[model samples]
Target: MSRHNIPDALWQRLEPLVCLPRKDPRGRPAKDARLMFNGVLWILRTGAPWRDLPAEFGPW
Candidate 1:
């Protein structure tokens, strides 16, 4: 896990709260919720603009 990523303990709690999309006859699939959540956390944790997010988060 990356240092900036969510910890498993916290993720266990958070994972239950997110609703993911199914791939059945849908539009573009949603990105991985874990990564997206981590990306959001990264920005909030760093207090940085979304454009300034690290590349490790992928195309912020």
Candidate 2:
């Protein structure tokens, strides 16, 4: 996890709140909610555009 990323305790709390991703017959496999949520958190925390998200976070 990144330095500014959500803590384990908070993540544990959020895990139950986050909806499980549905399987899309015609789409690629679903992404982990933790990773995607962290990506969103990074954008919100840094005020950066989705396209400008860091490489470490994977494709934008």
Candidate 3:
């Protein structure tokens, strides 16, 4: 309903795929992997800048 045009279904599938594997080689915690994946998808889908993503979804 906002300027964010990424589809809901596409995002749903991507959410889990993006959230997993958050562990780093050194066991360091990763930031919101979900947001990162979503950002990348958004860029590819809508060609929008990563910095332009909504604050509520968090940053890439």
The candidate that achieves the highest lDDT relative to the unseen native structure: 1
Q: Rank the models by TM-score, top first.
A: 2, 1, 3
TM-score of 1: 0.71
lDDT string, candidate 2, 1-60, tens digits:
679578999999999778555666687663677777888889999998899988877799
Alpha carbon deviation, residue 53, candidate 1 (Å)? 1.1
Per-residue lDDT value at 15 in model 3: 66
For residues 1-60, what per-residue lDDT tens digits would candidate 3 score against the true structure?
A: 344445678778766765666445676565755455555666777777777766766754
The order by descending lDDT is 1, 2, 3
lDDT of each: 0.82, 0.81, 0.62
Residue 48 of candidate 1: its Cα lDDT?
92
Residue 59, model 3, lDDT: 52
- Stretches > 4 Å off in candidate 2: 21-29
**lDDT of model 3, residue 56:** 60
User: Can you give the lDDT of residue 43 in candidate 2?
Assistant: 91
